[model samples]
Target chain A: MTAGPPSLTQDEVSSSPTRCRILATAERFFREIGYQKTTVADIAKTLGMSPANVYRFFDSKKSINEAVVERLIGEVETLISRVADRPGLSASERMREIILALHRDSIERITAHPRIHEMVEAGMTESWEVCSHHVERITAVLARVIAEGKAAGEFRVADPAHAAGCIQTAILRYCHPVLIVRCPGDVAPPIDGMIDFLLGGLRAG
Target chain B: MTAGPPSLTQDEVSSSPTRCRILATAERFFREIGYQKTTVADIAKTLGMSPANVYRFFDSKKSINEAVVERLIGEVETLISRVADRPGLSASERMREIILALHRDSIERITAHPRIHEMVEAGMTESWEVCSHHVERITAVLARVIAEGKAAGEFRVADPAHAAGCIQTAILRYCHPVLIVRCPGDVAPPIDGMIDFLLGGLRAG
Candidate 1:
C-alpha cells in the first residue's frame, strides 16, 4: 500500500542545484555524524567544493545548517500554502487535509529520518522564534480555513483558534511513529478516529 | 492552587541543599550562556572551585550535563511513576496527571529557559536512544496501568499497545507548550479531553 521513499522532486531549482545539493549532502552528513560534528569543510568536500567556496555560499557552519533546515521546512511551508490556496475545499476538510499531510510527512519524513530531524531540532535549540514562527504560520493557515468553514455554515466552533491548537497537537502526535505504533502485532491506534473527533467536535450541533 | 517548583525529594540526588545549589547555579549558567560556552571550568569557577577540583565530583563536562538533566527529568519520572503505581487511578487518570505535570514543567521550566532546554534536547542529540529510552520506559509504565485498568473493567480498550501509543503521543504533545496553546484572550481546549480521546475514541460506547 505504501511506496518506498518517493523520489525527491529535483527540478524545482534547476538554476541553483548546487546549493540544494550542498544542503542535501549536509543533511546526510549531519544525520550520519551530527550537527556538532559535521563541519563546513566536510559538507563542501562531500559536495565537491572547496571549503572556501562553501564559505561563499554560507559564511559559517551555522549558516549552512540554518540553510538546510530552512530548505526542509520550506517544503513544509509550501504544503501549507498549497492547502491554503485550494479553492472550494471546506474549512473542516482543509483542516483535515492539513493534519493528514503533516502527520503523514512527519511519520514518513521526520520519523524515518529521526537522526537528521533530531539534528535539526538541536540546531533550533532554544530558538523559540524558529518554532514559534513556523507554528504560527501553520496555525494561521488552519485558522483561515476554519473561519471560512464557519462562515460557510459547514462547521460549528466557538473558537477557531482553539480548534487550530487541538488539531496541531493531534497531528503532531504522529511524529514519533515507533513509539506511537510499532508494526507487527502492535495494534496501532486508529488515527482516523482522531479526524472523526475533530470533525465531530466542530460540526453544527 | 499551583505551587512553585517542588523541592527535590530525598530520593533525588539533589535532595541535599548543596547539590540543589549546584543544580540551581548550573541551570542559571546553562540558561544565561550556551551549554558549550559554559564549560566545567566556568561552572567550577562560579561555584568557587578550582578547575581541577571540579573533576572531583563530575568525571567530565558531559557527565555534569547528564547529572543536571537526570535531576530535572528524575522529578518528572517520579511523578509519573507515582501516578502509574496508584491503587485506583484509571489509565486515563494516570495519563492526565502525567500530561499535566509534563505540561506544567515544559511551560514553567523548559519554556522559561528555552536555550537551556534546547541544549538539553541537543545534548541528547547524539542519540535518540536517550529520549527513546525514556519514551519506552514511560510507555511501559503506562502499559501496565492500562492493562490493569482493562483487567479491572475500569477501562475498555481493544489493545493496550495501541492505547499506550496514543497515551505516549498525547503526553509528549506537551513538550511544545507555547506552540500548542495560545496565551491570551483564547482558552485552549481542555487537555482532559485529549486524555479521554487517547483512552477511548470519542465515544466509549
Candidate 2:
C-alpha cells in the first residue's frame, strides 16, 4: 500500500555523476529510438559503461524507467504547484490557468517528443506505482485551488476535495494523453467549449 | 471513413436460423474459451458446418465478434431507451435513474460474465467501428433525457447534446468496463460521491 517510485533527490543526482550519466543516456536512447526497444545495455553502451556498472547505480531496468518517468512528472508537479500557489489571481482565474497549463504541457510534450510520450503511456498502462502517485499529486494541486475558492467565496461547493476530483474526471478528455490524441479528429465537442461548460457549471449559483 | 458494423435485424434473425445459430454458437465459444481463442473453424466445427459456410454469413472472424458484441450492446441500448422514456418521472428523476441504470447495468454485466466483458473491452480498445456506433447511440439516449430536462425546467442547459456528451466523458470512470476494473481498491474517490458531485454541478443555479 505504501509502494511508490523513489524520488531522485537533488543531492543524489548532483552528488553521483555516474547515476546522472546513466539516466541522461537512457533518456537519449528513449527519445531517439523508443522506450520499448531501448535497453539498459544500450544506455550503458551509449555512456561507454558496462551494463553491470549501470546496474550498480540502478537496481534494474524497471527502476531506471521509473526514475525517468518520475523526473518528467516531477517537472509537471513543480510547475502546477507554482501556478496554483501564485498570488494576485482569483480562484476561478487560477483554476482556469492551471487546467489550461496542464493541458498545454501534456499536448505540447507529446507533440514534441512522441517517443518520450510513449514511455509515459507505457508507464500508465502498466500501472506503475509512480504513475499512480503522479496522478494523486496532480489532483492535489487542483484540490488546493478549489479549497482556496471555497475560502474566497468564489465557489460554493460543499467539499473541495470531492469537487476537485469530479473536475479532474470531467476534464480527462482534454488532459489525458491518449484521449487528447483521439479527440481532435473526431466530431466530439471542442476542448475549449467543454472547459467553458464546466467553468459555467462551477460558476452557476 | 464510412465503415461501421452491419446491423443484424430481428427480421434477419427470425428468417435465417443458420445465421442465428452461428452467432449463438460464437457467443458461447467466446464465453467459454475467450474471444481471442475462438475461431471461425471452431465455430463451424461446433455447428457442423464448414468455415466457408460460416464466412458466408459473417465477412470475417472479426465481423462475427462485432456482431456478438453488438448484440450485447443492443440489449443495453434498448434498456437505456426504456429508462429514458418511462412515464411519470420528472426529467431530473429520469436523468438520475437513467444514469444509475446504465452504471448498474454495465457493472452488473461485467461482474456477472467477466469473459463477455472481455469481448466488450476488446471492441472498445481496438476502436471497432461497431463500438463507436454503440457509444453514439448511448449518447443519444442521454441527450434525449437532457432535452426533456431542459424542456421541463428541470435543467437550464442550453445545449442538451453537448451536455450529454460531456456527461458521458465525465462518467467514463464509473461506466467504462476497463476503468471499473481498475478503480476499486485504489485511493481514488468513490463512484457514488463522484456522481453526487456531478449531479450537484448539473443542478447548479
Candidate 3:
C-alpha cells in the first residue's frame, strides 16, 4: 500500500469544510452559553441540524471542547515555530519579541471571546494534560533561545534552562492580573518596568 | 454598639474539641482521598460518628472545606501580624523576611497539603470570591511592608505600591510550578539564586 502524501499545511489539515463549520459554530456557542451550559442540541440547532447529526461529528461535548482546545494548541505551536525560525535575531531580541507577542496576542484574543479563555481556565484541572504539554512546548522554544543567547555571549545567565523558566514566570506573573485574576480598575503599574527589570537582570552589569 | 474584645492568641483560644476534631479529620481526609472523592460520611466514619451527626456541626461539604481554607487564611494573617510585632529589624530585612516567609510557608503548609491545594486550584472559579479576597488581603500586607520600608529609609524605591506589586509577582512566579502546573520529578532550581535575582531587580542600584 502507498503511504499518503505528507505535504499538507496545517490549514489544509484542519480546514475540511465540515470540521471548520462545526468548530466555528461550537466555539461561538461555547463562548456565548458557556461550556457547562452549552448542549449538543444548541450546537446542532445553530448548525441547522439535528442533535444526532452533531453527535456524528463529535463523540461528545467533551470531544468538541478537546477539538477547540487542540485548535488553540495548534495556534500556540505556530507561535513557537515562528520565534524558532527567526535565525538572524540575537537571542535577547528574539526572546523579547516572543514575550511581547504572547502578551499582546493574549490581550487581544482574550478580549474578543473572554469566556473562551475562561473556559480553558475552568477546564484546566480536568484538561491539564491537553494544555500543559503545549505550555511546556512553548517553554522549550524559549529554552532554545536562551541557550543560543548564552553561547553568543549576548546573555550572561548561569543556567539557560533556569533563566528561561524565570522569564516565563515573570511574564505570567505580570499578565495574571490582566488576564486571569481580573484585577480592578487598572490599578497596577506599567509592564515597561518589568521589562526593564528583566532586561537588567539578563545583562552582565 | 460597643467594640468587640480583641481575640487571644491561637494557643490561648480554646478551640472546641468537636470543631478541632472535625477540622483535623477534614484536612486528613482531604489529603488522603482528595476533595471530590472525600465525603462527609468518610470524615464521619473516621471520627466514629454517623454522617448525620457530622451535619449537625457543618451544613455541607462546602462548609467543611470553607473551614479548612479559613484556617489557612487565619494562619497567614497570624504570620503577617507576628512580623509586624517584631520591632528591631531594619525595614528591608523585614520585607525580605516576609517574602521569604511567604515562599517558605506556602510551599510547606499549603503545598504539603496536596489535596486541599488541588481543590483550591480546581475550584478557583467556584470559590473566586473567597480566593480574590484572600489574595487582596495578602497583597495589602505586602504593600504595607513596602510602604514602611520606604518611609524608614531602608528601601529607596520611588514607588512603594509598585515595588510591593513586583514583590508579590516575584514570589508568585517563584511558586508557579507548585501552584499552577504540576512539575514532574524535576529537581527544583536553587531558590537562593532565584531570590538573589529578584533582590537584584528590587535593589536601589
Candidate 4:
C-alpha cells in the first residue's frame, strides 16, 4: 500500500506527528502480539504505509524498539528529575520520593501496556546502549541527590557516586521490570521496610 | 548413537563420578558451542551414551541446565554458609566476607567461562525456576546473617528478612553474572564501601 498520500512532503513523513504515530502503532501491535512476533512490515501495514516509508523515520526495527524504550525511560527520568528538584525537602526525603516515584511510574506503565515490559527485557539482554544510558541517567540523578545530602551534612557518604550506585543496585528487584516479576512474592517482604533499611544505611555516620 | 552400556545401573548413573563426568562434559560443550547450541544429543554423544540415557539422569535439557546452575550456586552457598558459621567474627564482618566472596566467585566464573554467563542470561529470561531457587537460597543465607546480627545488637533492622532481600538486590550488579558485564566500570565502586554503607545503615538506630 502507498504511504497515505503522494502529496505528503518528505519532511512531513519525518515530522513529530509521523514519529509519534509510528510508536503508538508499534506499541499497540507489541501489546497485542508481543515484540518478537511483531515486525516492521506489520507496523507499516497497520499504519497503511509502505515499510520503506517507515524506514525513513526509523533506520531499523531495532531502532524502533530502542526509540520505544528511550521514550519509556525518558518519561521516568522526567518524573525523577521533578522529585529531585523539589524544594524544601531534605536530600534523604527527596531520594525516598524519587525512588518511590520511579517504582510507581514504572509499574503503572508496564501494567497498562505489558509490551513495554517485554521491550525492556529484550533491551537488557541485547546490551542496548539506550538501556544503559537510561540506567546511567537514573544513577546520575541519585548521585546528585546524594552529593547534595553530603554537602548539606545530612549523610556521611564517603563517595556519593558509589553510594548512589549501591542504592540503585539494592533496590533493583523493585525497580527492574523483569526482576519485579522474577523475585518471589508468596513470602512478600515489605518494600517500605527495605526503603527504611536503605535510608538508614545512607544516614550520616 | 547408542547407550554406553545397557548394564549401567540407575545407582551407577546417580553416583558421584558419573554425575561429575556428565557435568564436566556439558560444561565443556557449553563453553565451546554455547548453551543454546549444545543439545542433549550432543552432550550424550560426547559422553558415549544415548540421549535417553542422559535423560535417565537429568530428565530434560532444562534439567541439565538447572543442575549446572545449581552446581555453580551450590559453591557460593557453601562459601556463604562457611562465612556465616565462622566463630569469633562479628555479624557485620561475616556479611562483608559473604558479599565479597559472592562478587569474586561470580566474576571469576563468568570471566573464566563466558558461556555460563550466557546460560544465566538465558535462564533469567526463560523464567527458569532453578535460577529463582538459587536467588532464594542466597537471599535466605543473607537473611540468616542479618537475623544473627539483629540478635546480637549488631544491627537495628526491624525485619531481617526484608533487609536481606534489599541487600541481595543492592549487590545484584556485583553478584549477577550478566549485570557484572552490563553496568559501567570506568568508575568501579568498591564493594567494601557499599558493605560499609549497608553496615552503617543496619547499625542500631
Q: Pick the candidate with the highest DockQ.
A: 4
True contacts kept of each: 0.18, 0.26, 0.21, 0.46
Residue runs of model 3 more than 4 Å from their true location after superposition: A1-17, A48-57, A80-90, A174-181, A185-188, B1-100, B107-163, B173-197, B200-205
TM-score per model for chain B alone? 0.69, 0.85, 0.73, 0.86
lDDT of 4 by residue, A47-109 (tens): 898888788787777778877788778888888999999999999899989988877776786
The clash number for model 3 is 0
- Least lDDT summed over 10 consecutive residues: which range in candidate 2 chain B? B1-10
Label model 1 with its docking quality class: incorrect
DockQ metric, candidate 2: 0.31
Cα lDDT, model 2, residue B155: 75
TM per candidate comes to: 0.52, 0.82, 0.60, 0.80
Native-to-model Cα distance after best TM-score fit, residue A171 in candidate 3, in Å:
2.2
Estimate, for each residue in B1-205, the C-alpha lDDT of model 4 and write its tens digit.
Answer: 6535454566876685766778889878776778889899999898898877777677676667777777877888998999889999999999999999899998888778777776776666554677768778988998898999999988888878777877876777678776676554423357887788788887834
lDDT score, candidate 4, position A90: 97
User: Residue by residue across A1-205, what tens digits does model 3's lDDT show?
Assistant: 4343234455754566766788888888777767778888888887887766555566687778878877876886687669766878877788777877777767766667666655575446456666566667777787788788878887776777776666666677444422344433233346666665665556541
For candidate 3, the docking band is incorrect
Q: In order, how many clashes per candidate?
A: 0, 0, 0, 3
By lDDT, the candidates rank as: 4, 2, 3, 1
Stretches of candidate 4 off by over 4 Å are: A1-15, A82-94, A125-127, A143-154, A158-162, A182-188, B1-13, B82-93, B121-129, B140-154, B158-161, B181-190
Q: What is the TM-score of chain B in candidate 1?
A: 0.69
